[model samples]
Target: MKRALLALTIVATLATPAYAVLPDEIMADPAKEARARDLSRELRCMVCQNQSIDDSEAPLARDLRLLVRERIAAGDTDAQVIDFLVARYGEFVLLKPRLNSHTWLLWFLTPLAFSVGGIALWRQARRRARTSTERDEALSNLTPDEEARINQLIATEPVSEK
Candidate 1:
């Protein structure tokens, strides 16, 4: 029925891969195709900005995918393909940036900030705990007469404002 067809369509859509690699773009040699696919995952799609070339449907992504395959076909090593892309597009072409003088700050900043925030939270919690225990200790140290006076004060009715 219509409901069964709809359920099947949903299942089929979910089963399909999100990648944009076309059958025509795939290399004939299995080894070269594997290499191309691996490299495609590392390269960024220039037009899509946030997506890897392998995952992007942009025209520029297709061109870059083809270029990677062409490089592999021409006997370029994986390192050579990466180097060529880096040289042509700068470090921004890579999905994960390389660690260098320019990127050292970017790599180290997140962990440093997380450590600082964690330490700050720990100190704050300790301070609150100490203050609360000090308050309880003060209450415990109160004389029986003082405690009676406090209870009396609480039990007394407030004076009416005229």
Candidate 2:
């Protein structure tokens, strides 16, 4: 039983790299099939937003795989196929959106947010440090009369054992 389980585990591990491509969707031409696969890997599955069409098992992924193969069979260049998809679905179809004026904000927003947060934190630290220093200085610069009064009060006060 243990040996059977171990064999099953090995088989599953070996088969895990199998893609979501169906037999019917595969192109007869090896070159076109390979190109379709490369393009599929670059395309995003709308249903599984984080997974590429090549890896996603979603119905949308399967459709995209078939679409890519169909384009390849139609003699479309890789770039042309990508352009067609991008035109039809917008840049969101690509796993990585192209850098453009429209997307500049999306790409740069993170660093900009970090920079603003850092500046705010730095200003806060400076303000706190200044306030702390001012408080300490005020406490240390007491008048001689004040020190004398405090000493007198301490002398009169009864000491308690903790």
Candidate 3:
């Protein structure tokens, strides 16, 4: 019964629509079509919430795709089309926002953070190693008899089997 229930749950989950975009609406003009597809990849589908315009079936995505084709057909360059969209919809419409003064930190912070973290980790490891060496030196000062007693105590402990 449990196996049957799990199977049914999996089937139902797979039945749900992952995307609703239809292939028929894609343009056939080679250059313009490529630009349209590229623009679609850059633009976010607002209606679908989390999909790129190319992958979304939302009405807004269809409109945006058509807009891209229209602009490209009108002899607008890809950069111009992107600028127009950014001007009309703000930078939020772009999947990858441009790097500007405000975004400089965002662009560079990942590497900066990793470098800082690496330095901190190295310092901490060095400190630990130094402390461990000091501890070993102190232990070495103990007579050989003391080391033998400590090993014997450890060896006499009971072992637990899993």
Candidate 4:
């Protein structure tokens, strides 16, 4: 039973999809292969949406991994390979998107929205405070006759004994 469990554990570990880089996709040149791996980590897996091509098992991720290796083997610099993919697939294929005029809103809109909301909330709180103060003042301004009548009613009532 112990031997069978040990064999099962080894098989499960080997079968786990740890990396999407196939053995055949690896380049012969160590330097080029390293560059390809680095580039793959930055490229997004379109099918998976969140995983990098290096970590995704999707067919599109495999295709992208091959493309990166091909580009590196052809002597393209890391920046050139990234630019090529970005041009082909748009900035969506990048795990970290570049900042540009088109993406300014995407980067800045959250803080801008939070600031607007905070200001509105502060103004509302201030208005409520002012209204509350006005209500208190109105309630306290009883007529002199009304005050005397209330005093007489209080004097006429019998006090409860403990």
Candidate 5:
């Protein structure tokens, strides 16, 4: 019975919408509403940072949602609407930023950083291997007198047997 209740609860939770778009915020025209929703999904919630404006309950997200709907209703093309938001909020408003001169670093920095790190790690490993080889060579090339003294020290050490 408890398992059945848990399954029902999961189903109910999944069936619910997880958006912050209130009924009053929805457009009367379905086409405009759809466009607004699409644009909202592309925009980031300034307050929530990682969430889309459509999914965030922040006041700033709500304002952005209204602004998108207003633009759509004002007959702005999707591209124009996006451009306007980009102009106002900068590229940070875009969930997926465009690759331009200013945004090149955002798109390429991670892989470039990783490549540099990998090269550095490889050089470090090679240097350590070379150092280890040099140390072993130095130990192997000890003078005969040094070898004799080492043997003498080992022989003079007391050994206890249990």
Candidate 6:
């Protein structure tokens, strides 16, 4: 039992890396780590939608992670670091894309489309209602003589036995 327990503990410890990012990857200062973590959270994971680069294991995510750490260690302010990345990569690099002329239509299009569709449906229903004759006024357009002839034809029809 003691041997089996020791083996289990060793395997579990070996399964996980001592540090996901190597000591070489980290900046010497702890202050930079906080900012690096913040920037990482803001970055999108290209390989995994909805995940931040910090949480992703993809190579691209790792590269981005490294880049952020490098920038932070190089004495770049948080905003400057972010702007640098944005300059290198377009707005698509942002996990939450900013609202702009290029994306305004994309953001508002669904509601606009729904409103237009609703209007079209309402118009179609109004047109159909206007064009159709109600059963109560089936002969409203007919003269008295025409009405009499239709009634006579109905009266002359033979009845069928059920």
User: How far is 59's C-alpha from truth in model 1 (Å)?
Assistant: 0.9
**lDDT tens digits, residue span 88-159, model 6:** 988777887768987888789989999999999999998878667464377687889999999999999999
lDDT of 1 by residue, 1-162 (tens): 999999999999999979899999999999889999999999999999999999999999999999999999999999999999999999999999999998998899999999999999999999999999999999999999999999999889698899
Q: What is the C-alpha lDDT of each candidate?
A: 0.95, 0.91, 0.84, 0.91, 0.97, 0.82
State TM-scores per candidate.
Answer: 0.88, 0.73, 0.71, 0.69, 0.73, 0.55
Report per-prediction Cα RMSD to one decimal. 3.4, 4.8, 5.8, 7.2, 4.3, 8.9
Model 6 lDDT, full chain set: 0.82
Off by over 4 Å in 2: 1-18, 28-31, 144-162
Steric overlap count per candidate: 0, 0, 0, 0, 0, 0
Best by lDDT: 5
Write model 5 residue lDDT over 49-142, tens digit each, in one string. Answer: 9999999999999999999999999999999999999999999999999999999999999999999999999999999999999989997999
State the lDDT of candidate 4 residue by residue for 25-77, as single tens digits.
99888888888888888999999999999999899999999988888878889
Candidate 5 lDDT (Cα, 0 to 1): 0.97
Candidate 1 colliding pairs, count: 0
lDDT of 1 at 51: 92
- lDDT tens digits by residue: candidate 2, 58-130: 9989988998888888889999999999999999998888889989988899999999999999999999999
Candidate 6: regions farther than 4 A off: 1-35, 75-77, 128-162
**Candidate 2, TM-score vs. the true structure?**
0.73
The local lDDT score (0 to 100) that residue 75 gets in candidate 1 is: 91
Candidate with the greatest TM-score versus the true structure: 1
Cα lDDT for residue 33, candidate 1 = 93
- Candidate 4 clashes: the total is 0
